[model samples]
Target: MMSSTFLVMRERVVAAIMSNPVVGPDSAGTLARMNDPSQNCTFEELGFDSLARMEFCIFLETEFGISLSSGEIEASPSINAMAAYLAGEG
Candidate 1:
């Protein structure tokens, strides 16, 4: 089971992605991106790409006040999985 806090973070992450013009408000499109084998999602697919990865970390830190490793973030491919990981349930 995931902690309520982590669940909230996942919601925030989804909101963040949706805020991106490229992503927009289409839940289906975001889900497709998550399921794309070529992208393989992970955290790296959060549009981090190396340079942006650090920025993403910073964003998470500033937004959620939680310090997460790139590897930790990358290990989770789906929002639910990420939430579970963040919640320390996985």
Candidate 2:
């Protein structure tokens, strides 16, 4: 089972993905699938191109007060990876 903290973080990431007009609701599922730390589904698999990743960084900054460096995002290419990065676990 995933930790509650990770689940909470996942929900936040899902909400961020769903709220973005540029991303559809289906994107949330893709985000969720890619969020697994064990999976290598990657941001690219969830349709997060470079521009989308930048926008996601902005969203994370605005929503979670987490400012991710470009290198951080590049290294952690999934929602859980990003969450871990933001939570100082990466």
The candidate maximizing lDDT is 2
TM-score of each: 0.56, 0.65
Query: Which lDDT tens digits does candidate 2 get at residues 19-50?
Result: 65454335556554655545434555666666
Instruction: Give the number of the best model, judged by TM-score.
Output: 2
lDDT of 1 at 16: 46
> For model 1, how does the per-residue alpha-carbon lDDT over 1-90 read when each residue is reduced to its tens digit?
446776576666555454443323235665676443332234544544554445555666777787877676567755666666666776
Check candidate 2 and list the clashing pairs: none
* C-alpha lDDT of residue 34 in model 2: 50
For model 2, the stretches where C-alpha displacement exceeds 4 angstroms are 21-41
Stretches of candidate 1 off by over 4 Å are: 1-3, 16-28, 31-48
